[model samples]
Target: MTIDEQTVDKIAHLARLELGAQEKQDMIADMNKILGFMDKLNEVDTTGVEPLIYMTDEPNTLREDVIKQEITTAEALSNAPDHDGSHFLVAKVIK
Candidate 1:
């Protein structure tokens, strides 16, 4: 519909924005222009047109994930400076 200064002021207030007299007037004209453009778009006939999506027919062409067996615990703990049995020992962080 038509945008007025009062409508623009209400919108600005709702959005927690402060607009001066000139700014409010500018917003009204800009909003009316936007609404008029939308109205023009509404005149087009596209009843059977499908909604647009992000992608086309291109495949991902990604490689499959290769599952390898994990290393033994002893092999992992071998590099550690301090280890009790299963996990590495470090200084207590929490007090």
Candidate 2:
């Protein structure tokens, strides 16, 4: 389907865009060209072609998660400007 001025206006409004007269016309033309390209792509033969999901067949390799204590609670709280013996103190933000 071809893009018209009305469609361009609607798209611009949805995207919170403020288009000038020339810009709106340009958008309509660009959108029409994109649609035309999509229509051309539809004419291609793909009778038994499989959709590509990934570029490589190799499985993803990830390191296993290990739990280890890197620092004690006292060590973590040492540099705090404001703390209530065990926890950091901050001004109340929410009403």
Candidate 3:
């Protein structure tokens, strides 16, 4: 499709692009060239081409989730400078 100068100016306005009269004309020509290339690509034959999902053979590599042994309260609190029974105490996080 042929893109007119008015259409190009409208597009520039929508995209927030600042262009002079000559630049607008140039941009319209470039946009039409791109559209022409796309139209030419439409004539090519692609009867049975497989869609690419991934580049590598290994698509997914997820480790199995498992629960293991944990640490004791005293062991965890040993290094803490402040604690109260089962909770770790510190300066106020917010006013």
Q: Pick by lDDT: which candidate is best?
A: 2
Candidate 2 local lDDT, 1-95, one digit each (tens) = 98999999899999999999999999998999999999999999998999989888999889999999999878888998888878989889999
**Ranking of predictions according to lDDT:** 2, 1, 3
Off by over 4 Å in 1: 59-95
Query: lDDT at 13 for candidate 3?
Result: 89
- How well is each residue in 1-95 modelled by candidate 3, as lDDT tens digits? 88998888889889999999889889988999999999999888877977778988886989998887588898899889999978899999799
User: Global lDDT for candidate 3?
Assistant: 0.89
RMSD of each: 10.4, 5.4, 10.3
Candidate 3 wrong stretches, greater than 4 Å: 53-95
Model 1: lDDT of residue 48: 97
Measured on C-alpha atoms, candidate 2 has an lDDT of 0.92
Question: Model 3 misses residue 92 by how many Å?
Answer: 29
What TM-score, to 2 decimals, does candidate 2 have? 0.66
Candidate achieving higher lDDT, 1 or 2: 2
Candidate 1 vs candidate 3, TM-score winner: 1
Question: Which should have the higher lDDT, number 1 or number 3?
Answer: 1
